[model samples]
Target: MASSSSSTKTDPSAQGQAATQQRLTEAWVRLAKQLTSSKDYQDIASLVAKTDVLALKNEKLERELQDALTAETRNLNAIQEVKNENMAMEDACRQKESQVEAAQMKESQAQSQLQKAQEEVAVLKQELDSNASKITETVNSKLEKEVQIRRLTEEMEKMAESFRQTEADLKKTNQANMGQLKMAVDATTEELNTLKALATPLKPQADKRIPSLEAIEHDV
Candidate 1:
């Protein structure tokens, strides 16, 4: 009897709990249907779709921005490289200019030295020419002296031959006239003394000696 009494009490409470659960389920179903049919829900759905499109556009923009930044970085690097190359080229140009200047200076010095050498050579040539002229003049003077000596010698030889012939003629005429022979002998002696005076300067060079006045007179 106690068990039957406890069972009858739990059945009414169970029925009440089941009826409350059914009511809560019906309220949830009604709220869900209202939310699906509302304009706000459709607007939210549209907003979600637009947000997705905006996100995709933002992503594409970010990618394009990254590409642009990369390109800018590359351009900046290229510019720096070009600047460095320009600086190197400028340095090289300056070095070349300095080298050219140095070479030009050396060339100028060489030219100056060459000019000095040429001037020295010209002076030396002038000296050599002057010396050669002086030598030629001295040689010509020596030749003229030799010729004069030879002429003097020949004249002396001719005079000596004339004196010998005159002596021979005087010898032949000595028997014809003694007084005329004495006068001729005196005249021949005077002429021979004059010739001896004239030939005194050439005595060192003459191969033949003039006959002495005493010897000529003795021969006469």
Candidate 2:
């Protein structure tokens, strides 16, 4: 019985040992499966990190594109400004040309007026010359008439002086000849009266003309 009981106890202990070994093998398999799952999780995390890096690069490229667009817009605005300045300059040049043309027209008009004035002056000068010649001719004719009148008046005064001298000589001779003095005095009186009447007609000529040489000598 003791042998049988000891063999029974040994067999039960061996069965228990076998059962523990089987349990150990199951736990090891479960641990290996967990390890594989951890490997998969790590792979997924790495893939996510790569995706994030790609996204960051894409954002940086977009920023660069925006900056390029802004720079192009600024350059376009600058070009437009330059175009506006050029157009303004062209307009100013056209205006200056118009002003210069107007000034030239004014100068031409002034020159035309000056030429007309010169022609008018020439015509006036010719008219003045004709008038001056007429005036000179009239003055010369008047002077010649005055000179002729003066010469005639001088001859008349000389004739009156000769008659007076003849009368004086006859009076002196009559005084010297007392015997024939009556007849001589009668004839001399008649001649003296005739000479006086002849000299009396020069009153109008005396008022209208200059004195003769005889008249001046008599007055002196």
Candidate 3:
């Protein structure tokens, strides 16, 4: 009788448990139907679509950022190259300026030397002019002395010719005077001889009367 009473009680408990399980299954089905038909479900669907579009936009923005960084790096390198080229150009300019200064200095020295050479040439020209003037004066003086010597020589020749003529005339006059003196001496000697001959005859007669004349003159 105890075994019969336990079997009857277990069969009632199992039937009640089956009823509870059936109610839980019905509630889960209602909940699932409500969720599928709600506005929240539609909002979740639209949000998922918006998230896909945002992901695509984010990928494009990341690619643009990477390209900008690459361009900036190239610009920085170009700026450095320009700076180096400017420094080299400045060095070349300084060297050119130094070369120009040296050329100017050499030109100044050449001008100074040319000026000195011109001054020396002027001095030499003045000396040459003075020498030419002295030579001209000496030539004129020599010519004047030659003219004077010629005049004196002509006068001496004229004086010598006049003296020769005067000597010839004097010699002729002396010869004529000697001839006349010889003729007069000869005439006087002949007259002296005639007078001596006449005086000899008279001397005898005068001697004979000399004594009588002397007696008569003595008586008187």
Candidate 4:
């Protein structure tokens, strides 16, 4: 009976030690799992926030580059337009210079023609003055010749009237003395015949000296 009572006491002590070791190991495992899960969640949150900030910075840089390219295209077009306008202006200036030269040539030709016309007019005036002077001299010579001709005509008329009176008186005296002086009357007849012969020649000489009124009018 003593041996059976000792074995029962030892079994009770071994059972109590094994139960305390199992409880301590389960508590340690629960603490280690909670610590590892919290560390993984913190790392994921930090990486997502950094990616959003980088995307916003990239979009701003792209907009600025497009604005600069559009401005450069507009400036190139404006420079080309200015160059075309300058070329047109140069062509117009050359055309104007050519027109001015043609006008000056026409003016010079007109001036030369005017000077020639003036010289011709001066020559004509001199010829007209010379003709007028000659006409005046001819008129003075004609007047002097007319005065001399009139004086000669009046002298010849007076001489003819005196000869007619003398012939009438001689004829009356011959008729009264014819009976008493027959010989003398015959002698007087012969002398009268001779005088008639002389008078006939004198008539032709008088006709040659006188000019007709018609001939003088025609010469004037």
Distance (Å) between predicted and true CA of 50, model 4?
A: 12
Clashing pairs in 4: none
Lowest summed lDDT across 10 adjacent residues in model 2 is found at: 202-211
Q: Looking at model 3, how many pairs of residues clash? A: 0
Give Cα-based local distance difference scores for all models. Answer: 0.75, 0.66, 0.60, 0.54
Per-residue lDDT for 1-220 in model 3, tens only?
A: 9988887675777889999999998888898678667878667767877887888887877788778878888888898888889888889888888988988898999899999999998998898899889878766655554444344334433433333343345456664553443344345434434443444433322211111222322443
Judged by lDDT against the true structure, how good is candidate 2?
A: 0.66
Q: Between candidates 1 and 2, which one is better according to TM-score?
A: 1
Candidate with more favorable, higher lDDT: 1 or 4: 1
Candidate 4: tens digits of C-alpha lDDT, residues 1-220: 9888987675766777777777677666666566446766456656666666666766776676677677777777777777777777777777877777787788778888887777777777777778777766655544443443334445433433332333344456564643333343334434444544444433322222322223322433
The better-scoring model by lDDT among 1 and 2 is 1
- Backbone clash pairs in model 1 (N, Cα, C under 3 Å; residues 3+ apart or in different chains), count: 0
Q: In the order shown, what is each candidate's alpha-carbon RMSD?
A: 9.2, 15.1, 33.2, 20.4
Top candidate, metric TM-score: 1
The residue ranges of model 4 lying beyond 4 angstroms of the native Cα positions read 1-82, 138-220
What TM-score does candidate 4 reach? 0.37
